[model samples]
Target: MFTSGTRQLLAKSNKLCLKSGSYLKTFSAKFTTCDLYALVEPTEPKVVTENSPGPNSLKIQAEISNFQDIRPMIFSTGIPFSSSFISSLPFCENSFSQISSIPLGYNHHAILDVCSSPEMVLSLANRPSLTLLPPTNWADKLQNIHMKVAPKGLTNVFNTVDGSSANDLAFKAAFIAYKEMRGLPDELSEQELSTSMDNASPGSPDLSILSFRNGFHGRTMSTLSATRTKPIHKVGIPAFKWPAVDFPQLRYPLEKFEKENAAEEKRCLDQVEHIIKTSKTPIAGLIVEPIPSEGGDLHASNQFFQKLRKITKDNGVVMIVDEVQTGVGATGKFWAHEYWELDTPPEIVTFSKKMQAAGFYHQAQLRPKIPMRQFNTWMGDPSRTLIAGAIISEIESQSLVEKTKATGDYLMSHLKPISIRYNKLVQNVRGKGTLVAFDCPTPEYRDMFVSLMRSEGVLIYACGNRSVRFRPALIFSKSHVNVFLPRFESVLNKMYKQLWS
Candidate 1:
């Protein structure tokens, strides 16, 4: 049934092509193109050695750790093992292994095809400073891809280098808009501009971006001031005296505790309004994650977000939804906030990770009257945008968003019972699509669970104090979930027995 030509391509590509049963079957009936590309079956995890960071991986980590923190280092392996590991994992296939930033999968054929294109090569080789000299195709690229997918009610885009830059830019836009709303002129007087250099009020302006307790924006000066997850990140740095509001800590199995959760949300919303109304330094904006990811995979209801939106709008506070870790089809929707069904979209929605390009989408009003005020030498990279364009195209072509929604439901259904069975170690099993998480009884137990999982050849991570979060790629399939569930169940059973014993 093998066509000599098809066989040649497969051999040359070193990719597998499965034929349907029976050499006697007609060639066309037995060997379709879909059979060649579709995930045929889940592969078993191959742990060649007892230890996760096998001898070769340990050596590589040691060499790299000398020059870098490597404190968060996971063992490194050869491309073959890396690729194999990905194929067997839930979030990304090992073929194109990377940090969780991978959108589709490792060595995704679509991405590789884009990479091999001449235009992509040219963009890569001749990287443009997008703000100063945007490529001729920049407008088309934005209109066709990024703009096409903009959150409802947002019509403008301010491209940046990454998630932190997106947040920083959004904060700047909010600050400017806040000032303008308060009757500040577009052009600051020479005297006011001069006084700004001295960091005095009326020029530098006494305003802040209110953030929730334990929320993370980024590590840049302004962003760092708003981040409050850990002291280790802020130990020696001088942070702004910005107001911090309490993010609701709701009891989980969210349905069972609805009344309590509502009260908690109301309490948090009240605090947000109070901060805006009474802060010594006026609150120009409020930034929050749809679901607090790095902070702890914390989630609030749609009602909570809707209320926050209303409060911010009424108080003239710019509402910024940081979807850096939650955007681009992972949460069953392109943007997680889409689930909120906001009366009007948040004033700004910042994105990065899965989209590959970082930027904030906003209403046209957020655009500054002056041009150079909100810019940099390289506002964004065209090569990255091209890649992002290709990614968005693939998502549309393959219907990966709907696929992710279905696959995520399968995975969560599998996790729910595990949470019930191992009630002590696993609690609050909840998520939007594959953006799921549960809590361990304690930090030590959480760390141990993660370690055991890695030892078993599954890479995972913990967030907040005692929560484990899953951030798989959009292309992750139900078969991948099947591969991970048993391994996860085994680990949970082992942990439960050990804790009980």
Candidate 2:
């Protein structure tokens, strides 16, 4: 139970603290205990110069560009404070800030505390190949980290290295489960084993995981097959002939377009069924994001997901909810799929990012019969798991999930008018928590708008070519929004004025 007065005081204190270099030292002195919600307040965005990367970033970039492809390189910041310059405007000062991927902000106290613990240090120094010889406390760490926030009815976890690998592993589980149901024996026969060497049937059977156009899973071989966000990520890389169905493209101002959006969802549902029934390859599973993140922060109603779950159950196809970008309290709920309230849990729910660990949660039945079938040398690092445990503890102790919901509502309420006022430049402002986004008129315009926002000292990210997605930390408070909104409005006004001028 966080009081508004406390929140305001903390925000004000943090603002003041950030302005001074002694904030960290003061914070360390004041709060010796590591409590989760102990620091849910706004911190000042450090701008040493007019630009983010300042002079230090350019030198680092110039040095790195000589050998490697530095196209994705943003400016770099030193330790304690991570920074990235907006690459498009190299000379622009105040252009570098943390991007949306930052969960608790750079060098979060809780995270650093966990890293400094003896248990964490040991795990990092003596990294084990978890698949073969996991640490003694691995099971306990899993219970504390992933299992603590496990979605309803999911008790088992298959840990992997990252989001893409998590989804890829889920796909493999689905394929194995489907084959087992088809009377395939646990042990491969001599013929099957020999044929598998040549990538033939019985081993490499004609199976596929159905995904949605514009949905992004990952860039790995199997996950890439399921990703359809952009051709640039797939070009020159071999991809599977996996089927992609249309995700519902709902009309904006949801209240005004409710009837049309319902019809659109129904149409997409029919298309999904059609693909499952008619594909040349058997559909072993269907992977969908609770919100199609990379596909432009696209959303479907709870009813839409419930109906999809029923459809998958009826067809004996595994239902996988890829929560890589939406999970771990970003979307109000710990798991975004919780919003759906389906009769049963998704067969697999994949997560990464904020969790600081990647894996799929499923029922006991989904576990492969043989151990080595679904394994890797370092399935997931224990130090990361330890950090994840700390994160979960902090989230619960501080009740950040509910806090995020409240703050997100606050943001959206303020953002709606901005969207309406600039309807031509900005449209379709929608999201479940702080995980919100809106579309700009064009890709170039969206990029420009993002750049301007960076220049104004607010960090944001782009998704689906024309949308600006907000992925702020759960600890973000209303005061943070107050600081952000004025800057955002100024940027919007500048854009509008520039366009007309």
Candidate 3:
């Protein structure tokens, strides 16, 4: 039941700017928030009516449906969203990770200040197609930001629109490098040129990317071929016959299943070897997520990842760590794969999400002999990168990575007991930093629990099938967690009565 007042506020919320002030001292003030960087105008959620996505949202859903598939409308929407939380009626702290974006949280003054800048507005007005004609400030911006935060070994960057495009371009780079390794001729033959037009053999080589089972790369043709999460995302679309191997499904409280998990990982590794040797189309690249998120926040031991690095190195296959979800301080470390401690770095690392900019990082060797083999009109957006630079500055100045790790330890310690008390409801409580997740007894239970948590004023999300994931922004603090945990317990208490009282 949105009032005319609430509706007007929601419509213009994006333009609501606030002057920066000292951090509010609330909830014990465990860790402090900077005056310039903290979230503002925080409010608690209010569920004014029964049923999530009440009449106002439903009416909006119908209106949007007249234009296109209204799937986004079907969601129990959090209408007025902010950096830390969203409010339909009940304002709840965000934990969806914004699908793992929103690095600083909704409207941090630093970012808003950047967004309101004359320079940022100019770029937004006349965006450049980066690959063809880069802005003069492009090199400076990359120097100050992207390169400043380049993954350990990778030197080059290719900015794109989103995680999917970042990965798609990364795959293209992999195939090009694969072709180079095979010593393919640069000049096209008459037959090769003609065959390409027909989408046949020599023209478009039968190169494939070897991915892991339950891994999700993207939804585009090449990536969707690698994606193996849900059948629905792939049911109607035709996919390439790319080969996939199993991602190790390790049992939790990892120490308990050490031997069995090692054996499981070894079995998976052996399959990778066999698949590479026997696949009909030669595998040009092997792409894997450090944590197979969306496939249910599945995790493997660091040793398992190291072994994977070894296997890809032994084979000619290019190793691509799809850091789209796990990068930028979410996983405690700056990069989740940093935990792997492999002898050699992966050839490519694709990133987006919290970084605000989307692209892959790779060594000089992966650069193609020629350009245009992988490009688009808007190679990337400069305005987004400007936001990214501010995020990087905040990350560095605030040391948010270290803060995230400490906060995660505190959270998991508290959550462990809840997992024990509510064993049937919350099991396998696992995480690295705040990229935490747990499983419900069933998908229906997970959905119900999420709605209940919202009523208690803590916004969370579900992934894989029965798992609920916590992806709070880097700015998430001890205060936020303290606020969150009690609400979580209250929901658990209410749920216990409803389900088992």
Q: Which candidate is the best by lDDT?
A: 3
| lDDT of the candidates, in the order given | 0.80, 0.79, 0.81
**What's the TM-score of each model vs. the native?**
0.90, 0.88, 0.89
Residue 11, candidate 3: Cα error in Å is: 18
Highest TM-score, which number?
Answer: 1
Clashing pairs in 1: 83-94, 86-93, 86-94, 87-94, 96-106, 96-107
lDDT of 3 at 419: 96
lDDT of 3 by residue, 385-471 (tens): 899898989898999999999889989999999999988789899999999999999998899899888666566988898999998
lDDT of 3 at 286: 95
Query: Would you list the rank order by TM-score, best first?
Result: 1, 3, 2
| Per-residue lDDT value at 490 in model 2 | 92
Error of 1 at 206 (Å): 1.4
State model 2's lDDT.
Answer: 0.79
Cα error of candidate 1 at position 36, Å = 8.5
Cα deviation at 121, candidate 2, in Å, is: 1.2
> Residue 440 error for model 3, in Å?
1.5
lDDT string, candidate 2, 404-448, tens digits: 899899999998998889887888899998888899989999999
Candidate 1's TM-score: 0.90
